[model samples]
Target: MELRHLRYFVAVAAERSMSRAAEQLHLTQPSLSRQIRQLEQELGVVLFERTTTGTALTPGGAAFYHHARLLLRLAEASREAAHSAGEATREVVDLGIPPGLSPDWVVRLLGLLRDEVGRASVLITEANSAEQLRMVREGRLDLGLVHERPLQALTGTRLFSQPFGLAVRPDHPLAARTECTLRELHGLRILAHGREQVQAAHDALIVAAHERGVTPLWRFAQFSEHARSCAEATESDAVVLTENSARRLLPQWPWLRLAEDSVDLTTWLIWQPATRTVVTRVAEVISGLAEPVTVPR
Candidate 1:
């Protein structure tokens, strides 16, 4: 029998009088009787006993009542669950970020996402610029912060262009200088992230240094903890990285800026053009960030 039959049976059993049950259901008494009769006939069981006092349930009716109520409750729960799933799918946004983004920037982005996007939540995945770009292009990531050159394939906005710097020990001779060119760093061993981490930016800086008739000892490390461990183990005199990374990874040491205009790292925010509106909102917030400044002291 249909759900309406179960409902009619329930109402009649609850009220005990057919006329009162019909009133509550907004159906005429004859219509209500016909519906109840249809349900009993479909089940091939007598669900109610008629008498002068009032209508009452049979033993069979009592048994069916519990099962009918339970079925209605389950149906309602299923509908609510489906609706909630749809809402969650719409509200969650996936974001990819490269390593060494400042904690302040991360916090600011997260806070703004909560306040501005309202019910949206961000799922952050950390990968290098290359991987992040690929993820964004492949539609796996809703938004990405990458260091690679802008592509015609995806929508992008440049957020910061931080010059590279050298982090050296206090006693190092270069520590006294605020900034120096790659040509000036001749013969000194310098550690940096490999091309695997920031392929375009790293390669460009190396090529520029070579073109300037400078060839220094090049040491390669990954990011943060790995770089620190390698610095302690190797004879590399200085660490070459962005100002943000240098300050966080080698705090208390001197940061010497590389004077060559081309010897710097730039970051961009990239996303698919047709992505969810929440992703576009997040991109706008990031693009509004003030360009980072370099401090050499």
Candidate 2:
């Protein structure tokens, strides 16, 4: 089958609505529906079924969705490989994002990079703010989203910030609260990221406590590559996290905002002087996506 059929199928599956998918593809609803029907006819399977809420994928459609996405990604990589023929070497941009960054943003970024970076391959790595800063300075990373502004080692742009939230266990006292104050945390064991991952944030928490004369028992860890950190923190009174990180890591837990008066933790997009063209382009796309966001209960 042609690649357009696969592309149309993927888009429809993602949107779960023929009309919305057609709108995104810049085609009429009827045209998009006809294309999908032709694809299903060729495959001899019913791909989508109408549901009360929206279009739902059939069993075959659900299975095909995973393969179709991989095939499209492979197709893009192949084109990039072919386009690098005349060059001495292919360009690859290594980008580092903090653990607290939103997964939705990461997916959006990959899609943007594929469309914008002409002949370069972009790779994403998960690193905390301090690690990202160090990697950017040591030339291990081309771009980084860090929690603090870097010094002489790397140049930085203020992008955005996410306020801290609490992931409290169901049994915890604060679990049902819509928002929490520092004073409420007094005498409770509050789990947080260690200095290795976010020194500035750690210091800010301490300062926030001192300012309010509220002292909660502090427990810290350098979160590993996965959501195991959430599991470990469940033993504590509550785990401090941003909304995005809490949602991505441990969606089952009860999350509430930690609204403090004077605490600030900002994200800075970092890059070295004379960064590559592709690196700057991808960074610009990330910068464009930056805006102050807050999670609603």
Using TM-score as the measure, which candidate wins? Answer: 1
**Where does candidate 2 have its weakest 10-residue lDDT segment?**
224-233
Candidates in order have lDDT scores of 0.82, 0.80
Worst 10 residues of 1 by lDDT: 288-297
TM-score of each: 0.66, 0.65
Give the winner by lDDT: 1
- Model 2 spans > 4 angstroms off: 1-90, 224-234, 262-264, 293-297
Over the full model, what C-alpha lDDT does candidate 1 score relative to the true structure?
A: 0.82
Question: How accurate locally is residue 68 in candidate 1, as Cα lDDT from 0 to 100?
Answer: 92
Please list the Cα RMSD from the true structure of every candidate, rounded to 1 decimal place: 12.9, 13.0
Identify the runs in model 1 with alpha carbons over 4 angstroms from their true place.
1-90, 260-262, 290-297
Clash pairs (backbone) in predicted model 2: none
Residue-level lDDT of model 2, residues 1-297, one tens digit each, is: 889999999999999999999999999999999999999999999999999988989999999899999999999999987987767664888988877666776777788777877566878888887778879888999998888878876777777777887878777778878788888989888788788777887888888887888888888777744544644644577777777777767677788887654355678888997888778877787677666754222
Q: How does model 2 score by TM-score?
A: 0.65
